[model samples]
Target: MWKRLLGFDPATMKVRTEILAGITTFLTMSYILAVNPAILSLTGMDKGAVFTATAVSSIIATLIMALWAKLPFALAPGMGLNAFFAFTVCLGMGNSWEFALTAVLIEGILFILLTLSNLREAIVNAIPMSLKNAIGAGIGLFIAFIGLQNAGIITSNDSTLVSLGNITSSSPLLALIGIVIVSVLLIRKVKGALLIGILVTTLIGIPMGVTNYRGILDWPPSVAPTFFKFDFSGIFTPQMGLTVFTLLFLDMFDTIGTLVGVSTRAGMMKDGKIPNAKQAFMADAVGTTLGAMLGTSTVSTYVESSSGVAQGGRSGMTALTVAAGFIIALLFSPLFLSIPGAATCPVLVLVGLFMLSPIKDIDLDDYSESIPSFICIITIPMAYSISDGIVLGLISYVLINLLCGKRKKLTLPMYIMALLFTLKYIL
Candidate 1:
């Protein structure tokens, strides 16, 4: 029944492989379980209710991605999106939390319409192959930077902006050790190497005191405080255009960047196309729409899904496993939270290395393509944004081609995208 439903084949992806891939994906991203509530609760929202909303929304989104798209990606209220909600929308804009959620719902609806109209695919296809490959490679570096920062392996500097942390710090030291362990296992072709590295790192850190053995079980928090909460009355109020546009633009491109990056790593891209592109968009759209109604921020695909792809998850069964993990986490939050960032940080750094493999495919000979691609690959980590890097690349691609007498190379949509991103920066 499972095989028929998910189209899983032992010859291609074993049941154990998918199951492990699912759990590994969850392990990498489960930080959101605690992190999301912490950020949003600053706005006077109930933390427990936000926690339940985060977990439940993730399950719904991941299941959709698994079953509808038949791909190994997971979805949740996005990390950056949530921050924007708390910092920009709720606090900075001085809007109520309920009004902010309404904005998210509106953005989701607009995204669904765009997807149904084929605009999303058109934008994707308009992007040149060089940029696509570059997006994939850029995301690789982005993921690595995230891991390093999370584990304290990298720290902020007054002059340099980012510099190495004290390696002797217990958390950084443990993460470094985990990196070594995972690297050795991968060298030996050990199966489930990333997952093994994480669990072992957690155990080792317990003695170092970077990890705690939190109790194994807990009951879920009630969602009543936030459930069905929305300020629909103010959704159409003035001065909301920029906020709405920002949410829509960020979520759309964020999803695009993740899809391109993870798919490239998993060898899922073919002839410069993402298979089931529409289904992937639909999954995110539905997740965001339902998520807002459930009292969370915008739900979208997580780049941490790359961890699952690295774990050899090819089918939706891997996604199914991730969904199951989220469901189970409601009862085991303590256990899930116990696995510290020092442990899972290694998976991100390792999988990031895995993602960079596609850079070998980029067209280095063409300066036009190579230059923009170079800007993208380097700027992603430096700018701390995948979408920003892609936008800069796109903007440069259009201007360069137009200036180089390759105006014919730039398509109508390409020029339009370049203008849009330019406007994004300007206004």
Candidate 2:
């Protein structure tokens, strides 16, 4: 029954391991349940409704990944994509939140068409092996940076852009202690070290006054305010086209990068191609469409799934576990949200280290390959954008190889991607 439902292979994967992996992933990503509604609510949506919608949408999308795609990845309304939906399309462009949701709906439907055409999968396979390794390493650094910032271990600077935070402060101190605890457990080869570390740190934070323990159980918020709330009056405008294109562009490469980077780190790539690539894209497309209909932003595969993969989540059971977590979260949000960012931040930092291990495989002697790879590695964290890093890297790869007369190394998709990326910047 487990095998049929979640692709559980008894010889290779254990039920306990997959369950622990899923819990670990859920702890790390549960912040999205709070963060997404907070960001989207800025456009005047009801916070509680958005919260319910977030969980429902995540549950549906992640369930698809579990049963159909059969990969240990989770989907949610994405971080940056939500910011774009709320700030750029709604606030900046003076469009209503309903208008933005309509744009997302269009983008999601188009994503389904593109996935059916295999365009998204083609883009994934087109990335050379060297860049693929670099992407894994880059995502590592990117997630690590995110952890540090979230825990206040890294702070903003006016002149220099970023600087170290006060390590002695409550949040940063708790995170540092959690890192040491996790590191020690990891060194001792403890099973479920990541999940244990997060829980322990969260408990420790309660004493330190860092974690605020809200009451555990409550009725879930209604989805009425945001459900099927899209407005299509502005759908045919040029601005709507731009908005949909931007949403598609952002979700596509972000999903592509997460799919490639996480699969690469998990050693799930076979013959330099992701398994079940079509189904995976379909899961993501369905997630985005559903999320839009439910009154959220674009949904994409989260990079945090790497934490689960790091914990030996090899099958769809891990994703099924995540879906189960979200179902619980709908009612027990206060319990899950009680886990402060500082507690889970350490796990992301450690997982980042795990993701970076692939860097050793990149051949430094081949500058043509290595240079673009290096660009991708540095740009992810530096630019604080995965899609931007990939765009710059691919554009550089095509241009440098062409300039060096190494045309044989480039694929037709490579040329087309470079041209499209260039046009993205130009237009």
Candidate 3:
């Protein structure tokens, strides 16, 4: 039964190893419990409710990956996509959270349809490799900038538009300390470094009066505030279409990238392909759809799952363990919700560094690819819009290649995407 259900061979049970690996994966990525609510709550969602949603969605998604895909990967509200959901879709675009939820729902449905057809692979292939790497790196910068702002490490300057804040101040000082702690922990190869950093920072902040002491352990908060709150009034607008596309784009690549990276490390790939690629994509697609209904951002497979894989977790038992961990986490709403923004700043900064690793794989010698990649990387944070960065990058790629007599490099899907992006501006 275990073998049929979770690929758990009794001969090689190693239940202890799988359990430990699961717990390790959960602790490493559990920082999202505090960080996701902090990011999504910026758009007026109830922070407590968002915390509940984050946990419940993670539990559901990870369980799906366990039972259906039978992979060790865990899923949760993704870091970069949550940033885009709050900063770009809601705050920057001046849309209500409801509208953003609608966009997410659309994106989720579209992802399901795309995963069902050959179109998803075509779209993924249409974008150049450099741009794909740039998208991840750009989001890294964007979220890191957000972390700086939240910690008051960066502040608005009327004259210069942005300037450094006083690092000697209480919160900023604490944030700096937190960054050092997280960096040291990561350097030491500590499991759950990010979560441990957040907790340590929060504890340290108590003496400085930066972190309010909130009691831990409470009944799970109600998800009523954000659940099923979609608004479709603007569904036909260009902005809606663009937002949905951006959400889909981010989730697709993020999920795929993490799967490939973790699978490679776990020796789970066969003949240059993931063993259950379609089922894995379906797990992510379903997670996003259900997560939207439960009131959260896009749910994607976490690269942190690689930690579990490294711990000898080669079956769905590890993912099931992660789901169990999240179920226990659901009771700690007070603690997670009380984690001040300053506590999470270091995690965001470190995660940004993690995302930027892909850029090293990008070919810098090719001006055509490098220029567009650079534009995308700079525009995401500078323009304060992930969607705009993607649109600009695609348009620039097509135009530069066509003008340079390198049109052969552009695919049909690439031209179609570029034309649609151009029309987005013109219409």
Q: After superposition on all CA atoms, what RMSD does each candidate show versus the true structure?
A: 1.2, 0.7, 5.2
TM-scores for candidates 1 onward, in order? 0.98, 0.99, 0.73
For candidate 1, write residues 89-150 as lDDT tens digits.
98998999988888888898998999999899888888888888888899889988999999
Question: For model 2, what is the error of residue 19's alpha carbon versus the real structure, in angstroms, after optimal superposition?
Answer: 0.5
Model 3 misplaced regions, further than 4 Å: 1-51, 66-107, 186-196, 223-281, 295-322
What would the per-residue lDDT of candidate 3 be over residues 346-395, giving only the tens digit for each residue?
87677667667767867999989999989988988897766677778889
C-alpha local distance difference test of each model: 0.89, 0.94, 0.81
Give the range of the ten consecutive residues with the poorest summed lDDT in model 3.
264-273
lDDT of 3: 0.81
Give RMSD (Å) of candidate 1 vs. truth: 1.2
Best by lDDT: 2
Q: Residue 62 error for model 2, in Å?
A: 0.2
TM value for model 3: 0.73
- The C-alpha local distance difference test score for the whole of candidate 2 amounts to 0.94
| Stretches of candidate 2 exceeding 4 Å from the true structure | none
